[model samples]
Target: MTTKIRMTTPLVEMDGDEMTRIIWKMLKQTLIEPYVDLRTEYYDLGLEHRNETNDEVTVAAAHATRRLGVAVKCATVTPNAQRVEEYKLKEMWKSPNGTIRAILDGTVFRVPILVDCIEPFVRTWKKPITLARHAYGDIYRDVEMYIPGKGRAELVFTDGKGGETRLVVHDFEGSGVLLGMHNLDESIANFARACFRFALDMRQDLWFSTKDTISKKYDHRFKDIFAEIFESEYREKFEASRIEYFYTLIDDAVARAVRSEGGFIWACKNYDGDVMSDMVASAFGSLAMMSSVLVSPDGKYEYEAAHGTVTRHYYEHLKGNPTSTNPMATLFAWTGALRKRGELDGLADLAAFADRLERSSLRTIEEGVMTRDLGILSTHPSKKIVGSEEFLREIRLRLEKSGEAGRSCR
Candidate 1:
């Protein structure tokens, strides 16, 4: 007789497009469905479906995730004007991620894959560096106006209570750039809370960086708010966990990140994260192996592949050709979301399954059975390169062998 296992909660599934969407379906059928009984509520968020639903599907999915507390997503197209014309979209809908993030009120965390054979540009990085980008207002979604002639550009901050006000003036003699950006006190506080939660979750030190020295009044407010939150709310917890929260200037933090060995959580403001995450991705290697997670301040979570739809690879796959697209990140998305779910439910066995799956993936790569991206980085001359399906098969075989070993020990 076989024992039955069940999931306590349903996982919100947002399906996507191109090469990754194809990989996402295959992973579920091959790796996940075989091991666990999942309660999955799926929403078709593919390009055509999104256009058909006018993106209501994405909003509904986000709401479901917020309600269910866990979501696993596949990479989807964030349609631009060109994409709209190419796909013949109805209206250029806002990014599905943007819509969901707005509703969920979360920050996105991106972590790179660290393999033994594929070396990172930052040699000191022994472990993966996870970056949490505060996906709120600053430079992105800002109001801007062109300052014609040499008129003074001023930033005025006014208190909602009384008639108290602060002003910053840019007195220019010639033509120059003038931009105004702002962050709400509420948003910044939530960002700080999320960063601290992520640090606590991962058991890593948290680092926050800003150019407070230059923009003392504006950026300094952010620094001071984060400091106050740390001292008041997180200090005791951080001390107990043996984790530290250090504040540094942006320039200094970048230098240190390059020199220091990786194993810390770095929280960045909106603009900085957008730029820095790309740099980190390049440093690590292929974007194909990068994983992303959205963690709300309220602790709701969603995980997905960080790379895009991989349109080029999808075309090859269309021709019935064996495409060597990397599926590690998508697999990690499932493991990460499930691990968090297991943790929340206090199901150690389920959590162990997630751990085993992750270990199996890494070990498969270590044993020389890998997709093309890592195949190019092969250390052994005898290592034979495999396609995506073949690589997945190799991992499955490794997992089965390990399971047999465990059973034998029992």
Candidate 2:
């Protein structure tokens, strides 16, 4: 047997739940362990374990990523009321991804894994569009109140100097609802820098959108920060890279995105990002085809799939049925982590192996061997749907055939 590639530092591996957890193992065993001397600081972020540890494991994993510089995570269940009963948890745990994002203070960048057989639904989209989502404060951290009867509501702030500022929110006629949302200036600055740096790194034009005219103060603040940072910090750098930085209203941006050939980074606020990311993923292909990476301001990275744990698929598997679940996003998550790890540790062979594995996986699909989700979307003339494990095995066959050179771990 040929040797496996080595790693200088261990990756923080966050295990997940449901069908994705099952596929995570299959990935390492079939596609990765065979080629690399896999080393990871494993943390079980699975629902049951999160329940047991009170989700402290998620926090530890995020800290580990900060220390180690890279991590690969699987999709975990963020329990609702139904899930709390199903898992029989003490309390509903917060989202593991959310915990990690807060600790790392990162921006999530999601890009579609394009393929020859599966073209984007949008006819003008010939290239992949990257979504640089600000992963902090907005509606996600909102405060709300359900007004039971007619009353006045106001926005009040007490400054550090003990001075008062106030604004009338609304005077309710009867029953109504109210929401308050905010973002910090520091966080906004960090988000802008992350987006600008990512755009420069990819050498792609950066497009930022917000309903500034409508939002006035709130959304305009985001626009101002991005513009301020761009003019003072990134203008020359962007000009040197020969890339443009454009800002438009959200509505106009959407129209431009649909009409233009896609190849740029779109910076969005928390809520807009959450909604538009799904829209972008669906337009390009399946959400399962999107690859997401959370990049911290300090350069820490956590790569994960944008999809959720396939609960329905897990139920089928529990019944001992062979299911054809797509593993592209999960597979790419590992490859993304590996490639980043190798780059940081100066392991060219390890990095090359990651690159090889990704090409092989994509090649397998292009050649018509894929899981059911992709098979349905694939327009390839000779497409064949395979079970989850078989889909990976097919990619493994290609990876080995590519003659990736690695040193023996034994």
Candidate 3:
């Protein structure tokens, strides 16, 4: 009997919706199940299932991640008004990413999967750039109102010690807008630590950006916290590792990012990260090839692809049309979660199998076998573009050819 890699801990697996959903199953059937004794605490985050469970399944999955230490998630649909009608959903569901991020108090980090054939548009780019996004409260959870006329907005704080503080945020002049936003020092501290720890793990420099020069208190707090944490806890290790952390104005950071070689982690505020990550994904080639992970301050991790559910492809697939959705990032999600689970559980063989799968996937792309998206962007001209399932099959063949099918990860 061929021995399979043993998994000592169950990874909390969150299944998503649509085309990527289809790819998720293929990933397990072809690449993972054949070699590993798979174990997972499965949560169906599919739109229908989320609705059927009143989204309690998502809550349970997040809790499971906290308990289990690792999770692998598929891309899910964040329903819109149209989707509510289409899926007969109970309500316009919130972003699964947002929901889980709030629960775990985590930061979302995005890193692209670089291949030789896939040349980043930026000529100077080489290594992968990771974005550590503070996905917590900021403008994401802000209260906003459209003012009809002149009005005063106040920031109020009641100490409950018989003293109250009130400051005028803005005095609106004819037909304007108002917003209230705040962040906790504790949350900022946690975000800093996660970014620092992640940068150290990747052995790369960490660059934190904010318009600290303008929004002095708000943005400066982020800068101050990162500086304080590094100086007090991580400076020694960072120096020993020859990696550095620097704070800069967001504009200056963007310019530097465009001109410089890519090998560091860019630490961003909630809104900035949301905007810039899309730019980074496109510049690197495609969102379909980017990997993302949510890392909590307490060390819980959830890995996922950095893209959305391919609704267009899913619709086409529903019509029985061939879909060539890129699966690199999704594949990485599984490998990342498995590797972390293996590390935490001392299952070296499981981790090694993940590593092998990753190499095989990359090798397939490098050899000019790719999906339609990559075939269009890849620098190589000698390419054989195939559908999603066919591409995965090609990867599976290469993985089997690696000659370590039954060997221990050790």
Candidate 4:
């Protein structure tokens, strides 16, 4: 008897740049292709290709993801001034992620790589705590002006039907900060829905935090909206799933997060997500190990490596030097997206394959077979550091051998 392999849905693949890009190709060749019969729609989204296509490639990729319901992406360059000069880019293009998020209107969830040997900065985090950031219309997109004269500062909100105004501040006596910004009810509603969806998907408790006490009317509105939505829509599902929705002050949430053991979904405002993600990344380990997923409110998804292009190491690799680049995050991008795709299509075998791959990667690390980043943290520091090719080859060998010997069977 022979086992049959099948794919219920296609996965959109956006290839990217630098060290992880190299890892991306290697991963598909080794781990994914060998196990599953994947129907992948490939788009070369490397910087050069992006420039050649005038960044239309990214837009198309996002559309494909929306249609297909799942996308696995490599970490691409969000080119800045330095990158513009280095790559001789025609224009300083926007981040591919930003472009995709705008199209999908999604929230980005970042979760760290938790290895037993690599101790987290926040010692209490035994499990990975996922952070879902509402990636729209807050500090990221704000209108501000400095008040030179002592007049007044008002946040005048106007609707199409009528206008209602609120004096955000009055008597600006001293030279201080003044800003006017707002979130649309539509956007906030989508964000709340995404958070609820993510928590339900992960079967984890959802935590929301805000400075609602201080920003009573503004931030409080967000709090109230989330609460209302949760109560009206998500309460029953959350309870049924044996998960909970928690709201708290930002400071208190931070304190609780540090003290408590991990394994919860933290729904954050834009600014908080940006800041806390870095903290979470650092606590977990190196940025190279973090996995990120952009999940739209409508259930469309794109998963990717969370770190930037390792330019420093890329230069060495360009010189034909053996670099110990970690491919774990990139690998997870494929697995995570595929797992979601499986769930979406009700393909249990495909989902199980992803689970197996994830376990294999983690087991490889736990067994002291890792790249330089993780090898450095080994209890026996004398462990040999492996190059990119060597490390991946070793991982492949281990995965294959484990399957053959049925090591995990017992």
The candidate that achieves the highest TM-score relative to the unseen native structure: 2
Compare the candidates by lDDT and give the number of the best one: 2
Worst 10 residues of 3 by lDDT: 401-410
lDDT of 4 by residue, 363-392 (tens): 677666678887766553335578777777
User: Residues 153-187, candidate 2, lDDT per residue (tens digit)?
Assistant: 99999999999999999999999999998888988
Clashes of 4: 0
Cα displacement (angstroms), candidate 3, residue 209, comes to 0.2
Give lDDT per model, in order.
0.83, 0.91, 0.90, 0.83
Which RMSD does model 2 reach against the true structure?
Answer: 4.0
- TM-score of each model, in listed order: 0.85, 0.94, 0.92, 0.84
Candidate 1 local lDDT, 197-271, one digit each (tens): 889989999999999989887789889999999999999999999999999998999999999888998889877
lDDT of 1 at 399: 64
Query: How much is 131 displaced in model 1, in angstroms?
Result: 0.9
List candidate 2 segments past 4 Å from native: 173-176, 403-410
